[model samples]
Target: MHAIEKQKSPMQSLAESVLDAHTANFWLQKINPLWSVSQPLGKIIEIQSAATDTVSLKIKVNRHFLMGKAGQHHPVIVEIAGRRYERTYSLTQLDQYHVLLTVKRIAQGVVSQWLCNTAKVGDVLHFGQPYGDMTVTPEQQPALILLAAGSGITPMYSLLKALDYSNKISTQTITLMYWVKQHADAAFANYFESLAQQHANFKVHIFHTQEAPCDARLNKNHIDFIKDLSNSTVYACGPSGFVNTAEQLFTSAKNFKSEAFSLTPIISDEGGFINVTLTKSNKTIAIPKGQSILVGLEQQNIQPQHGCRMGICNKCSCNKVQGATKNLVNGVENTEPRNSLRICVNSAQTDLIIDI
Candidate 1:
């Protein structure tokens, strides 16, 4: 009869645990085995005008920086007015050591303003590894469907350009549906038109919500398009509520997928912090309201496996054995025993028991 003893990790200790600063550093160095792989740190090399307010930046990354997938996003860390800020932008085109990122100048966007107003051609920008799983695949099923809104077309542009560049245009049929408030608001509409001129497998459908004589109206025709897509493989990206109606439109459709790295929402959880126990690590900790549990844990020097900070990536998915959460946008509260929550977007409102 051998006796088994349980050892607690530093994050597991309720009270302050003894840890040497150097040991923590050493442990962090070995934490994610593949974290050492070189990632991009872009430097603005050139900027090209695409539209009135839209600018396409040609950034030069070192060769060691990993090139992103056709539809992946990379976090851009910038400093403005002595304050640090971060934003994610999808690559418009992937080139060797120079990926093109196009951004529309928002009226009051902090980082976008800085990049548009202050950052010079030679300014260095810290970039994270390419993240996001919403990518187009050549081997993917036929009749690919892409839906986007405003700047959401960033990822779609990458995928379309990649396919055309690789001469894989004949592999799959694609129907790209884009919507904008006005005709002037459309980005890369001319570009899509130019590509459609030569490519036979791609088609573009633009819906100008405010203008007359547009090809498609907003009401129910979009739903009809969703139904017509055969062997459907959906890839959508955009504002929070832009496409919420699709869940019902494609309830019966298969291979439905969406990607949104829109922004870090500031919705208040209102409720106070609650305690949570990470079962795998045997850790107990208090989680604050109005803040993502995953982020709060990271602030306390606790790192749960995370990829994209957005819930769409599912890298931060954790099993919820107890407690409740209100879906910020959908209002569909999630409270199932074996169900998983994307901790990146979910906040703790009550004491939770998690099987992390």
Candidate 2:
């Protein structure tokens, strides 16, 4: 019996056991292919290619799907070549039955590349609870400014569609400044253009960095396009450099929110090697000084628990029993023993022992 069933009486258990679902564990999913229970699984019902290197998947969530506020992200898990990988994505709710996820193919990105190239209809994947705080709240219903570049436009797209669909703002005074490398790389261009045509107050400005070099980027000259910029709440997402540039330009906005892609540090080979003791695995490996501990472990054919692989998710966090490590995000070094650190973001600076 399942652990949760321990609270029931013998007679109650017997009475409920008449149904195969109550008596048997979740093995029914495999035993009977037609059964659909309240599991946290989603089936891919449709797939659409959105742009040059991007694909949108329409997933029909299970009965137990818990919807989240628009613009929030959910950690999705998919298996490929007998190895499971996890990544976080912002969901666009089509309705209670289905949601949309857009994946942009990154160079050598495991999950993104798989979804864009090989994933097909009828594929089922698991997802964790929705997370992220980039949503628009009722109190923030003022003039809005959304700045997005590359794949960072996803969360902002969710928020934009939710606001427009809910009719929460009658004036439609949302201004979106989207930056892309070229015209072909821009996703959802036609949808944005349609919104601009339907509403007089809704405006969109597209900056093509490659095709129209001189007219691209956000600077002092672009600030004139947004009316009442000081009173607007600005949300920006993109690469770290683009986000930092947006933050600097929108310093005077009423509220500023930003989320950037994980920072990729240039791992240098200036320092000598150090020993890394994996306590649980009862093994030790020599890792280069300037590389992430996770990458170092993987080189030795050891896999540790991880999700998002970016520091945003705490799944890769483990105890540093002794020695020093550095945070790649801020360049801050920690030397105190018996502390928790994210293996994905930190590189070893000295001999270390960790609980993995």
Candidate 3:
């Protein structure tokens, strides 16, 4: 009788489990029902030269169904030498049913190196879902001040394409200040030159770090150029230092906006192991190689807050009570000298004492 009851109880529990999903995990799935999604590393169709070192990547998404917002960014996942890596890139255009991405392959970059060297037209890519807060609304009716450095010109390109090519928005003019190392480093020079040639409103200012024949240097003089310009709504994107410097430069009375694509540093043990202490539960856990602090905690079913999981939204920002982590993009070490860590990007190094 006991044996029979055990089997019957297991079956009963399975039946009850199905019914419980509606009540407990209803919000686990997508908010929109019709939005089918997949993350395939797309095929590289064309890679265009904008200026010098700046290159625009045009990729075709693997899709017979489902679509995405024009200016959203998607994660690019690649496997190299049996190691998996993921990085985010913004969509440049909706060239037919396939997707498009523009990327500048920095010499110090990992994924960028792969794309510049090995990525070809027929090669497949594993892509994450489109995400970003930088979409343009046609009804917003605000003059755009586009600030970009090097390859950060991508999002602005998407907005420009949407606003100009699609004729979706009514605008006065778009003032674009695209800073690069030299004229050759500007990725969309020809395209923007065409816009400047054709439109009375679209204007571009190129600031070169290196002495170039046809541009302005992005020094105090470059910042001074905007002093007389109208306070059109500002939108800036670039490297961490570049973005911060631009923000400080435009920090007068005029309102300037900016977004950063910088990643926090993550640390790990020299021995490829780490000790993670969840100060909340008063428990210490050991994390081995190839695991992030977030994954380490979540393996025990600890669900932490996350927005954009790609280090952008900063929902997972937490104060680190102790220890260290390395930056994934740039191999820089950061110490938790006092408080908070974005656990999503931070990995455990040595014995970490974290207050969740």
Candidate 4:
């Protein structure tokens, strides 16, 4: 005999046909902003000043949200003036249902400015699944060097908290070198100092580069004070130039991992322009080679959806109909047709057609 299968009721069938999931969710959100059929949402619970130009928000996430690893980043979506804007920020999981997001206001950053100044307690925000590979593991070396610059300290703070929660801090030697423009710009300084005092194996150093008698930036000379580079695991997060310098200085470490929040696109020596055809928009534009497609498009008054322009988020990804492109970050070239390309990190090497 065949097994019986449950069938949908007439009302259920009618509802599914008449109202899509998005329409239903729109109604659901009217009752409770955090309520969603499938979208992950978070309600801001607490707000505090983190630094001179930074704010920390404690958010309570809904059941649909999936907590990411300590050092991963989550795409935050917010609506402003009926237009949705997305940005990626490193999240620190406070508990099973809560996470902390820190925002450093940028001069012209719409999302950051809104998050830091306009967002209020009880306001809800949407989130995408977390993505990143710079995570902590049990197999890592006992000696860990965490190097952070400016807003890059957020992920390092998360990593440290995770290590402390797992009771691993007491067994390992951890050193944190955090760089900021001034002492007032340093976030979580007290917390890190207290942790270092509580745990003898932990050490914290705050370097202010723009203060009186500035401390030199990351260079080979700084490595003289750090012990056992050959046996230590080095993790760095910062601007492209800072991360690049760290990589060069610590290349001899046992293991090196890094993530850059901002990147300066590498200009190719072969200076030329390639025509890029947008299939959906029915437009063709000439873009310079070796420059990111996103930048090129913006220069031509074409703005594609983008976030965290550093290649950490997939907001700028588009389907390539045909093209040869090079990844600016890793210098990998691709000529395969019908492939997904991230415009923010990839430059067109040849005339191309893309689904934008």
Which pairs of residues have clashing backbones in candidate 1? none
Best by TM-score: 4
Tens-digit per-residue lDDT, 224-315, candidate 3? 54534455566777765566566666655245655556543333344566777777778887776444677677787887766444456566
Models 1 onward score TM values of 0.70, 0.80, 0.65, 0.85
Residue range 1-356, candidate 4, lDDT tens digits: 01223354454455557789888677777877876667889999999999999999999987788889999999899999899988889999888888999999999888999999899999999998888888888799999999999999999999998998889999999999999999999999999999999998898989999999898888888787688989999999988778878888998999998888876667667777999999999999999877889989999999999877878777789899998998776567999999999998888899999998
Candidate 2 has its poorest 10 consecutive residues by lDDT at 1-10
Cα lDDT of model 1 by residue, 1-356, tens digit: 01223353454242224445445434433652212123335678897776657788888765345667888887777878788676778875555657887888889687777776667787767676677778765568777788887788888889888877787766677788998877887888998988777767778888887677655533455766553554678787776455454444554555777665443344664656778888998999887765677877987788787665666556678889888765533446776677888887777667888877
How high is the CA lDDT of each candidate model? Answer: 0.69, 0.79, 0.62, 0.88
Error of 3 at 37 (Å): 9.4
Candidates 2 and 3: which is better by lDDT?
2
Q: CA RMSD for every model? A: 11.0, 5.3, 11.6, 5.5
Q: What's the C-alpha lDDT at position 42 in model 2?
A: 80
Model 2 ranges off by over 4 Å: 1-27, 30-38, 169-172, 212-230, 266-292, 320-339, 347-354
Task: Give the higher-TM-score candidate: 1 or 4.
Answer: 4
Note the clash tally of each candidate. Answer: 0, 0, 23, 0
lDDT of 3: 0.62
